[model samples]
Target: MRDAVWRHVDGRGAVCVVGDDFEGERQFEQLGVNPFVLRPGEPMAMYHWEADQEDFLVVSGEAVLIIEGEERQLRAWDFVHCPPNTKHVIVGAGTGPCLVIAIGAREHDSLGFTVDEVAKRHGASVEEETNDGGQAYARFPSREPTAYRDGWLPE
Candidate 1:
């Protein structure tokens, strides 16, 4: 397997395995896959919905799924399927690193960010509703490319 590439937002972010190489084609045309590594209380992304279907699998550790204003606890092997326009976000929980595989279809103009009270409580909602990702994460530090380190996963 190729060494994972990382991007950090306030010390937490995803370990991108599929599109790690930035010098060449970095994305798939029909779908996208990303493996996120989050610490306790860290959110994988802002609260949002997409016009295309998206799915998530809790590969290791635990997470809290905030979906449609409800919170659901998730553990390893748990899977979540989100249809078009299903509002959701995942926050790391439990005592260690949470590994989640996020997969989604690639459709044109397919996403929108939202501000939700439930998501705000978990630091996962944008300050204002917008379709632009740059505006949604404007207040936070940029996701700088970084080298992957060991121990993000268990032996």
Candidate 2:
């Protein structure tokens, strides 16, 4: 399970990691939560939920929060709570790494990803809701380095 964490690099050269997915030798599933840590200047593609509620927190560094097509700069310890079906994305801001902890209600009918011109400009891998993280990463390497072992990224 330690090796399951994967790395993602956006068009702007932002580094992100998938912390844990509670799969393969890991039975400790808690509310279907997943952890993602992104570097500065990287934007999470625009997306929304069909039924689940998504929430976020800044563990370190700062970021820009895009909600319903609007934007707001966030600082460390800041939190974002998205009710069901809210269209949003979080972009890393400032000069260094931005650590964001996000939680989503696992039980849901569907998840939706929207194509935003701004997201495209940021080099988001996925632009449509046809699937979760497919097209956006169609060209990524098959084997990705684990988040824990990536020394170049922030912890």
Candidate 3:
């Protein structure tokens, strides 16, 4: 009975977790791609990467995607394809944390930033907040996190 779930993990990003494939392997599953909230009037740093293999999609909110040295704004329901090793980065432009869902042909080692990984990469202190379900969510403060400039873009 596996289905998509969006239970509140934490308020940090309030990410709505979903699955890539309705029915498939766990490792190959693509979870929601999210980051810290983006406040208006503040521009978060951007990161460009050459992903060995993966693709990204903007399922909701407004995302400013810098792909192949070009910047474009993506609104709700808009989608962008970053082929393997292509340079790309996305920044939230709308009035909330942009919710992104990525589908990959095969799961890559790293799709985006995990809480812990982001903290470690940026050398920031992460605070853990527990939800009603007891799942711990990590939170950190960074006007500009390292993830801003370090992400794997799909070729």
Every model's TM-score: 0.90, 0.69, 0.44
lDDT of 1 by residue, 1-155 (tens): 23666776763565566753566464677788888888888899889999989999998999999999899999999999999999999999999899899998878557899889998988999988999988987777866677675756656
- Summarize candidate 3's per-residue lDDT along 1-155 as a digit string, tens digits: 11223222222232223332224235334433432233222222223333455455655567666565556777767876767656555555666555555554544543232123232232221233222112221232322212221121111
* Candidate closer to the true structure by lDDT (higher is better), 1 or 3: 1
Candidate 1: regions farther than 4 A off: 20-25
Cα lDDT tens digits for candidate 2, 67-123: 776667898889899998887788777877776777767566576777666555545
* TM-score of structure candidate 3: 0.44
> What is the lDDT for 141 in model 3?
36
TM-score of 1: 0.90
**Distance from true location, Cα of 4 in model 2, Å:** 9.7
Error of 3 at 104 (Å): 3.0
Each model's Cα RMSD? 1.9, 4.2, 11.8
Best by lDDT: 1
> Could you arrange the candidates by TM-score from highest to lowest?
1, 2, 3
Worst 10 residues of 3 by lDDT: 145-154
